[model samples]
Target: MSGLGMFGGTTIKYRNPTYTRDHGSLTLTWTDEWKTLGGCDLQEPTTGTDTKNREGTLSQYTLYMPSGSPVADNAQVRVDGQELQVDGMVLRIPDPLGILPYCKATLKAWKG
Candidate 1:
């Protein structure tokens, strides 16, 4: 736990993915099992110039989940009614004593 009380600032929604084969095709359809995850902190989104096209910008927010959170790497997140995808790996942060481990991931959306 962050002694600064950074967690529990806002609510988050996550959808664990379940894939199903399409009939006999090689394609797989992704299905979502939406669940609500509370006691987490969603920081304000920061904008930066789009590296690919420079014409628009990209927005990213850091999400801090509580220890033993059920949020998964393949899960999609919804914050403040905006759908954001996980930009990278979900990292576990632990204190020097290896206790009170928490998870952090970057949620990103492109506005171009």
Candidate 2:
């Protein structure tokens, strides 16, 4: 967390879905307690085209956590009290130089 000092103050909530069988019907439920991660850097929103061929805002975020952070692709993101969907690919930035030991996850999302 030494190099991540520049990306402090903001906290991002990562939500994961859970499924259960309710009377022979599969029910999906989201966890009430989200995994809160600190030291996240959220970049400014940029305009982009979505899969539906419609114009929308694209936001990129970087999370500073351990190497095996639970946050995964298509995971729900809640920031600034707004729920947002994780779109496209979730990339993991590797430290090839062995300089920074902290794990960084980069995610791009389409803003609704």
Candidate 3:
């Protein structure tokens, strides 16, 4: 409720704070919506799949976690910003594409 002419005009500028959706499901604090999901696509020309039998590209992937889901249950969590040190926690991005077309992440807890 700051700028009045902010729909379609050149004089539609405001001086306020800005934020982004970079913090998906990770920021569900108030409600049960904490921690969202990211997207990933898989198609042909990446996984080196046979163009005939095993043809495959970037496999679509998103954020997925169940409630009461133990972080040790083959969970693939991509930790950003700050890193935590846990005795039974392991974070890894299986593919090099991070979250491009084809990527895999495995955040599991190491059983020492």
Candidate 4:
């Protein structure tokens, strides 16, 4: 599996959310300590809704990470196990004669 097709597609588990502070109350708790890190690729979700989140329904996915792949910034992805949360800044696509540099995360989930 080395044709560079988004790391051969479908296989994601990236977790980076550790901020715990609850003793005097400042409010900051996001504990997700999962680390699997594989040839990630998940792109098949495009549902939207607005109007001030009428009932809530937004599913957007486009996660294909491999280059450097540290995945931080609202990071929490676990495909095939169902757990998606990473919707901001993970875009790092640079392959200007550098072989393969790919990383684009934007997986949002909301259903109600």
Candidate 5:
């Protein structure tokens, strides 16, 4: 809830996650360790030297899962330490888990 102090509430097209008394909070986290943002080519180089930040917008962002998760909408994404709702498409994580600045300079792969 920290988008310039303007949190984009969950979209109406998608409903909030249903919780139960037996279960506390269904805190779901994105596990897209694929090291790739769907298509954002911000992977670091294999030089094994410099690990600077990439100068580009993340082409695609993915939400992580621990199991065979079904496609769901309005899923809450937690970047870095901030928790935010992934509304319809347009994502603006003001407080990203910071960016993988080194991702563009280092040679690695995400298998999440």
Candidate 6:
């Protein structure tokens, strides 16, 4: 256990693509699961240069979950019945020595 009771007593719906089956066709199925103690933190926008040396603002968000929580890449996260975009990448912050205590995921997205 992380021993950190900062779940905020709320849950978030996690949706991910399961599989596709058809006659040479692509079918996307979303699997939904309720994750406990899920929290989201929005960070201040950061100014950075783009590939063309153009400055842009990037919004950051950190999603908190319990240790050993199953969160996949490109998964759709819904909080309070609203979907939020998870951009860039999903990073997992584990405990020391890869132990399972608590974990946090950082991603970038725009405000919705």
TM-score of each: 0.72, 0.57, 0.16, 0.31, 0.21, 0.50
**Which of the predicted structures, 4 or 5, would earn the higher lDDT when compared with the native?**
4
Stretch of 10 with least lDDT, candidate 1: 24-33
Instruction: State each model's CA lDDT, in order.
Output: 0.73, 0.61, 0.25, 0.73, 0.30, 0.54
Query: Per-residue lDDT tens digits of candidate 3, residues 25-86?
Result: 33211222224232221122233322334443223222222222223322233334322112
RMSD of 4: 11.7
Clashing residue pair totals per candidate (backbone < 3 A):
0, 0, 22, 0, 14, 0
Tell me model 4's lDDT, rounded to 2 decimals. Answer: 0.73
The sequence of per-residue lDDT tens digits that candidate 2 reaches over residues 33-93 is: 8888676656544453344445665556554554445666566778798666555335555
Residues 21-101, candidate 6: write the lDDT tens digits.
888887656755645335434333355312323344345556766665566666667766656545534566666775444
- Minimal lDDT window, size 10, model 5: 100-109
Best candidate according to TM-score: 1
Worst 10 residues of 4 by lDDT: 1-10
Give the TM-score comparing model 4 with the true structure, all chains together.
Answer: 0.31
The TM-score measured for candidate 5 stands at 0.21
Candidate 2 lDDT at 76 equals 74
lDDT of 6: 0.54
**Candidate 3 least-lDDT 10 residues:** 5-14
Runs of candidate 4 with Cα error greater than 4 angstroms are 1-16, 23-42, 46-54, 72-84, 87-106, 109-112
Stretches of candidate 2 exceeding 4 Å from the true structure: 1-7, 18-29, 48-66, 101-112
Winner of 4 and 5 under TM-score: 4
Q: What ranking of all candidate models by TM-score puts the best one first?
A: 1, 2, 6, 4, 5, 3
| lDDT, candidate 5, 1-112, per-residue tens | 2222222222122123433454565644444331212212222223433223643322234332211122244444333433335433333332256421111111122222
Q: For residues 1-112, write the lDDT of model 4, one tens digit per residue.
A: 2445347456677667666667866542455567777777777766544334487767788887788778787877878877878886788888887787788878887777
Q: In model 2, how large is the Cα lDDT of residue 26?
A: 80
- Stronger candidate by lDDT (2 vs 6): 2
